[model samples]
Target chain A: MKTQKYIVIGGSAGSFKIIIRIIKFLPANFKKTIFLTLHRLKHVRSGFVEALSLKANIPIVEPKDKEIILTGRIYLAPANYHLYIEPTKTISLSTEELVNHSRPSIDLTFQSAAHSLKDNVAGIILSGANRDGAEGLKQIKLNGGFAIVQNPEECQVLTMPTAALKKSQTKNIYSEKQIIEFILNCK
Target chain B: MIKLDDIINFNNAVKEVSSYNLSDYSKKSLGRRIEKILSDYKMTIDSLIKKIKLDSNFLEKIIKNITVNTTELFRDPKIWQSVKYRVLRKLKNKDTINIWHAGCSTGQEIYSMLIILHELGIANKANILATDINTDVIEIAKKGEYIYKFNIEYIENFKQAIQVNPYNYEDKIDVSFTKYFEIDRVKNLMTAKPFLKNKVVFKKYDLVKQDNIFAEKFDIIFCRNVLIYFNAKLQKRVVNMFADVLSKKGFLILGIHESIFGAEALKYIKHGEFYIRR
Candidate 1:
């Protein structure tokens, strides 16, 4: 049985609104840990958590370094650093050089989680301007994890999903509404 | 497919070669590194095991890449400003100061601290103890030579690193980067002055399961951005060790995004983004 122990959703540019809509549907009793690795300016102070928490039934938090990763919760990567899921299931943040000109790069989180969690990882790629998550989503599939990419035709920017499609062997292509259903089904 | 047995053998091979235990490091991270090394070098786990046994220098290459974390100069500048206004200024009258920098990768923060002490004119009175687990990084730290930073990147990092100073933002006073750094714009190399490097004693001490190397109690300890690699239990153990070595008024600093939570939080008193031993 392929149990979805971890769910990581990634996006950039125009994916925030879609994420909020998706997050709003996840129940508080969801049995897996969820991570949101969205692209944002390192210097800008964003109210992302406060905004998401208002609608999310489950706890939505911007993780502090060394913070424990609990089940049934949502974690947003803070800006300006690469977020890693350590073996102990705690969070490790690295300000290492940016990949694809972005810190909190979706690829870093997705790749780390895929390596650490292995087959238990389920990844979803959303609208983005870059190809960061493409390789990582492919890595997830290589590690025996499941992958879903938002249909490029439905995305605000098609490059990210299109790039992800080139690498990932996913049959679970879905629009925004269907992606929400896929998330709920994982629970 | 990589199985649990492969991971166990890899850790055993690492221990046999380096005499350092990788058993306690997060298996997830270790696995990631192992996977990367395999693909990058075109070797399977079994071949890598053979390389570790036959090749003497193989372990060193893996260890160096494993321990490196992101570090920058005067990183998270608000913390420096807080140190300046709250901690250093309060201790200015002291005849001597002891500062311990744990996991001081390549001495960026050490130079940054030296700059702060120099700006405060207390550089003469302070003795800094800087250490990292990596011997190579320690050697570089001892030299105190930094390559020049590009202006655009430097300015961008500076803006993000520092919290806007109220008066400086209002009055538009700019920071003169040259005051603390000796920059050779032509040679594209910046070397930290001798006065700062002279005061620092660099040692190789492992924070995890290592014997005590530091005998002197410190007035300030900078253990920033290192603990995130460890699990919660290890984080507590390391922080408690810091507390044991700290003086009553000693300051303990963490990364901008790290916190002193749980029972360990009781040992420190928070003061405007800085923490002091209670």
Candidate 2:
């Protein structure tokens, strides 16, 4: 039996529609545990999960603190909190000061996944206006995990993926369709 | 790199040398905190362990740094709005409403509650007890002073929770900031007025020990944003402890994203963002 894979997808400004498309594309039986950390307004908390869930084939959850990690489900970072992937296979939320001017920071979640799961992780950085996910993608590569970014030309906002490409040496840049194909092709 | 083994060793060393028991904290969060401490101080794990063994004062500072004290007034304004309409309104008829703020950090939350209670016209009937493991934070909570500019953004939360009625857009109540706090921009200080700070008692208490020092049952308990530091097992234990001390049909208010799970969750009825003790 193969070990489970942890897939982390991070985005900001322009990645929501793309995320919905990805969620719509993935099959219900997808075995990898998916973690989504998106930059969101701290006060507006209710609509994001519900909107994402409308077309999702797999279960989408904004996980509570210390919730057990399970395969075949998507976990979202709640607003105004930093989400961490624990070594004990549980999720932990932190109210620490914001990093990169964002809570549910892409860097925190990606770095945590890299540190805890090592080579069993795949970190994907998508379109955004800021440089929050850049160092995190670098950490993912440094930890022997797969680091991927959407191609800058294909991104709605090029700063995020471009920064990620400059920081992380990984050559696994993909278009939206190619990213979906890459996820589907994973064993 | 600080591994899980290093965290385990640190926990054991702290347990043997002091009254603190950190073995129950979530390893991933604790490990991250330890790694930050090591980098901040430029010390190795072995050196950190040696300092912990030799100096009790340094150990206390390390323990204080380990616990997170981040908080704001009227955090998650919607929850406060729910508290005004849902929780406190239900308990308004009682002669004395006892509320416990477990793990209350730097006093903003307590003041936030006082503002709500005052607005509801039930401030005088409430008795509040706030506690935390960190003595430094307890003192800050006692002082009821904070950096004005640092917390200026949360004033919007005040307007959202107190001034504007969510259900009715036309119904608006004008509440002044001067009613609860005195903000001095020149000095960069916001001090909670006497009426808000006088009703609450502050103390140093550790939730991990499961000891109820007050020996009094509470009508409502606020343990917001604190349980995320503990593992599932410890979280369950603390939830059960809260269940034991809460009055029948009392409320347990956790953080917006925090939850009670396992057998302990059955003791409370989930109502919106909070749990009602059954």
In model 2, the Cα lDDT at residue B269 comes to 98
lDDT of 2 by residue, B33-69 (tens): 8988998899999999999999999999999989988
Model 1 chain B: ten consecutive residues of lowest lDDT: B158-167
Please state the error at residue A18 of candidate 1 in Å.
Answer: 3.7
Question: Poorest 10 consecutive residues of model 2 chain A by lDDT?
Answer: A1-10
* DockQ score of each predicted structure, in the order shown: 0.49, 0.75
TM-score of chain B of 1: 0.86
Model 2 reaches what TM-score against the true structure? 0.92
Q: What is the CA-based DockQ of model 2?
A: 0.75
List, residue by residue over A30-113, the lDDT tens digit for candidate 2. Answer: 888899999986667778889999988899999888788999899999988999887778888998768898898999999988
Clashes of 1: 0
Q: After superposition, how far is residue B14 of candidate 2 from its true place, in Å?
A: 1.5
| Candidate 2, superposed: residue stretches over 4 Å from native | A1-5, A27-31
